[model samples]
Target: MKIKYAIIGAGPTGLGAARRLNELGEKSFIVLEKNSYAGGLASSFTDEKGFTWDIGGHVVFSHYEYYDNLLVEILVDEYLEHQRESWVKSGKVWVPYPFQNNIRYLPNQKKWECVRGLLPGERSEEEPANFFEWIINTFGKGIADHFMLPYNFKVWATYPEMMSFSWIGERVSVIDLKTVIKNILLERDQLSWGPNNTFRFPLKGGTGSIYRNLAETLSNHILYNTSVVSVDQKNKIITDSLGNTFEYEFLLSTAPLDILVTKWLEKSPETLINAADMLKHNGVIVVGIGISTSKKDSRCWMYFPDDNSPFYRVTNFHNYSPNNTPVPGQGRALMCEVSYSEHKFVDQNKVVDDVEEGLVTTAMIDDEDRKNIISRWSINVNYGYPIPCLQRDEALKILQPALESMDIYSRGRFGGWKYEVSNMDHSVMQGVEWAERMITGQPETTYRIS
Candidate 1:
């Protein structure tokens, strides 16, 4: 088959591009997805007990107006607006989210340590060499030791010193010494800090419903269960697993950059191959446990920084929407994210048991409540997180432009290899922007490596 454009992967990015192309009345493009359904990593599944769970804790919030507008158009009235109620578990105490802002909840001695480190004369003039140095330089030793260092290490599955600080943009909350001091003195809580403070979710179907609806609008253009096996970049030809071939002028790939370069490309440059190997990532095991009743009292999510829990984050999935659980008020669920990599290995077969033990150890579930768990479901995703390591930018610098020159526009979470722009909104906009650049000669602005 011959086409003007071929989009690989039917996730948000691919769907976004295809949706925009349909809106523009362009009909020369085809989307090929390996999975039977769309949404890629953003998809949801239901357990035997009828509780719905997302791949991870996926909340709908956007930094771009276009992405917001697109959701409004697709989901229509089938979405829920929610105020973020998040917390952090420090031993037995529950500190409100943004642990730095709510240090008043800490013990007297701990509070003094945090506040004393925040006092003047700790700021450094030299630049930070990595995320660890950056955190200490920006937040001082107390906050870093208390929350930032441990929590980041758990989430990233890599040492903070081994990762780069460039991707920390708005993903992490930078400290405000004055505001923190005022909050501590006033014994007040500061809950609003990140972009997801107020977000939305699908009221009926799980997070995947938004993308499924969007895909439904362009269903005829997408080819499901078709995996691209090889890419003849020189001739602009793609061969799928079923012995089918497609010829295209422009290619938009949402596959992982390393996989695309190493597995699919017929012949890759030595530097690009080495760069692909340098890219590091962590896997995630999302374990959802559905209980007969609610777990916490209206809290949306909680962060686990200490080793009390093997999981780094636990979200109250039932709070996202009533339909997420089997019954409205009587049924509830807990969704926990446990990350694993070379640095931190996990036993896949025993992960569910580990999560259960972690919950009891962290006091998330009591002995009586543990017996009330109606169903248990776990999914181990290989590409759970794209780590922003010290060598990531250098690798992307060598990989991206080389592929772009060959008519390959690789953009998305793993496709672009940029965690800062890897949110659902940013991933979709990257696709839309790529399509706009191809069809209208517009300059791409989303995935620039600096």
Candidate 2:
């Protein structure tokens, strides 16, 4: 089959691209998704017991007006708005969401150390080499040692020293010395921080509902269960696992760049292969536990930096929407995220038990609560967070333009290899922008080849 545009992966990016193409009255394009359904990693699943769980704790917040309008248009009034009620579980205390600003809740000695280390007097004209140095230089040794270092290690799996700090834009809350001291002195709660301070979520279906509904509009153009195995770039033809061949004038690949360059391409250069090797990511094991208790606390999610929990973050899934649980008032859901990489390995067989045990140890759930477990669900995603290593830019520098030269546009979370611009909205916008660029000769803004 011949098409003007062959879009790979029916995730947000592919869906966004298709949506935009439909808007532009373009009809010669088709989207190929390997999965039976759309939404990619942003999808959701329901357990046998009627408890719904997202792939991870996904919250819907956008940076673009177009994205916001699109979702509102798709979901209509089926979305619920929420104020972020996040916290960090440190020892036995619940520090406010920005752990740095609420160090007063920490023990006296630790608090003193954090304050003592806060006075900024540095003379480093040169940029910090890695995330470790960046943390120590930015937040000092106390905060770094107490929450930043260990928590980051658990979340990233890769060592902070080995990763780059450029992706830390808005993702990490840097300390404001005056605000920290003021909040500590007045004992104020500083939780209103970050762009996701207020967000929206689907009222009935899990987070996947938004994307699934969006895809429903362009269902005819989507080819599900069609996995592309190889691409003959020279001939502008692609072959799927089922031996079906497609000829395309342009290809927008939302697949991982490494897999595309290494496995899909007929031939790859040694340098390109080495560059692809430099790309690093952590796998996520999301364990969804449903309980038979209605929670009174309105906290949305909590971060676990300590060793008491095998998971890095846990979300009160039911709090996102009332319909997340089957029994509503009688059911509650806890979605836990455990990140694993080569540097930090996890025994998949025992991860569920570990998560439950850790929850008990951390006081998230009690022994009595364990017996109330009604349903359990878990999904292991191989490509979770794209680690921003020091070598990432150098590698992308070599990979992106080379692939683009051959009419291949890799845009998405893992496809772009940019954690800075890898949020749901960003990924979709990347795809939309890619489509606009291909269709109208517009210069791409959200994703840059450079």
Candidate 3:
């Protein structure tokens, strides 16, 4: 039977689009997943000791009501809510997030520089061209110099000056200058900022469970372990790795835009080539360490921006949910260390060893803790986070229309390629909105937000 819609990539975004179609009483669709599982990066895994780890560190934080409603509808009682408590390790001090607002912890000289930078001067007559300038203008030279510049370079694998600031919306927190000064003088913490003050997590499984359950709802329509080998856009047909072919009236692709254009489109449209060229991404090395420890109170994920640690972030997987790892009575702890790099040939064993050494050097885990090390493994995911470069807008402006002309809707983390809306909820909504737009000719949230 010919399908009304063929959705590729069965991640949250694809599943979300399917779910929305089902809710709207439209069932003439099928989902194609490259992996055997439903969740993409959000998927979970188990080690020999029954310790669970997510692809990276995924926290469930939503900005849209639709995401919240859909997650609740699918997971229901299985969901576990978590209070967001995060800290940044800077200059041998654990400063609370919104690191700018809490600069009292910094040395007096640094603090004075930050305050001085905040002092309003003749505003630059020219538009801030790069992300660094944009950040310096938005948060003052203080915060940018102290944390934003160095930390972002590590995260993006590119200099901030090379990126564009157009993507910044509600993603980064900008401190209230008056409040920051007051807090500094009073030596008090700035309590309020940003959208995700509190968030939710799935209790039984990791964040992937939510996507897994969502896929279960559309099980009949989803075809797993089916990789799309090629697409005949002119003929509206998709051929899988197994040599099976399927035709569709509309194609909604959640695959990375570059891969889709280079592999499927075949013809190098100027827009497609430019989009492919303008895009850059960072790969993630997720290191999961399982140790036998009884310490239960250290709950929140910690951020490391210092050169001492190779990881940018470390999530206490067990704290997110008791079920995330082995039972407490069984005596085990799971910690995830995230490292970002563009080079693919970096030694995995060496990275893992370096991470282990760094953990001890930073006093995150003691040397004696190594005795309880039962299982350790690393997952390397390429195209983990898309970088919003200086030429992204121009690239997208050309690429979006080209895809639309072919009746193809590209949406998701790397599909639409907008970091601001790349979270699970946002990615899912991108799929839903794209499908809705395809069916009803409505405007899509992904493009509209940009």
Model 1 Cα lDDT, one tens digit per residue, 1-450? 999999999999999999888777789999999999999988988778888999999999998889989998888888899999999998778899999989899998878778777778876658999999999888888888889999998998999889989988788888768988899888788889999999999997799998888888889999999999999999999999999999999999999999999999988888889999989999999999888976557999999999878899999888999898988656778999999999988889998999999999988888988889998999999998999999998999999889999999888989998999989998999999888888798887888855
Ranking 2 against 3 by lDDT, winner: 2
Could you tell me every candidate's TM-score relative to the true structure?
0.98, 0.98, 0.94
Residue-level lDDT tens digits of model 3 in 1-450: 479899999998899899889888888999999899999988988878788888887888887889888878878888777777777788777788778878888878878877777776823436899998888887777777778887787677778888999888987887656877898989998745767677788877787888888898899999999999787888888899998888988899999888888777756576588667887888888888888675655547777777787777888777777776677444445465554655323466588887788788777788688777877877888877888999877877878778877878788998888898888888888888877876677887665633
Each model's C-alpha lDDT?
A: 0.90, 0.90, 0.80
User: Ten-residue segment with the worst summed lDDT in candidate 1?
Assistant: 116-125
Pairing residues by index, what is the TM-score of model 1? Answer: 0.98
lDDT of 2 by residue, 14-126 (tens): 99999998888899999999999999988988889888899888888999998999987988999889999999998888888899988989999989888777776632336
Question: Which residue pairs show backbone clashes in model 1?
Answer: none
The model with the greater TM-score, 2 or 3, is 2
CA RMSD (A), model 1? 1.2
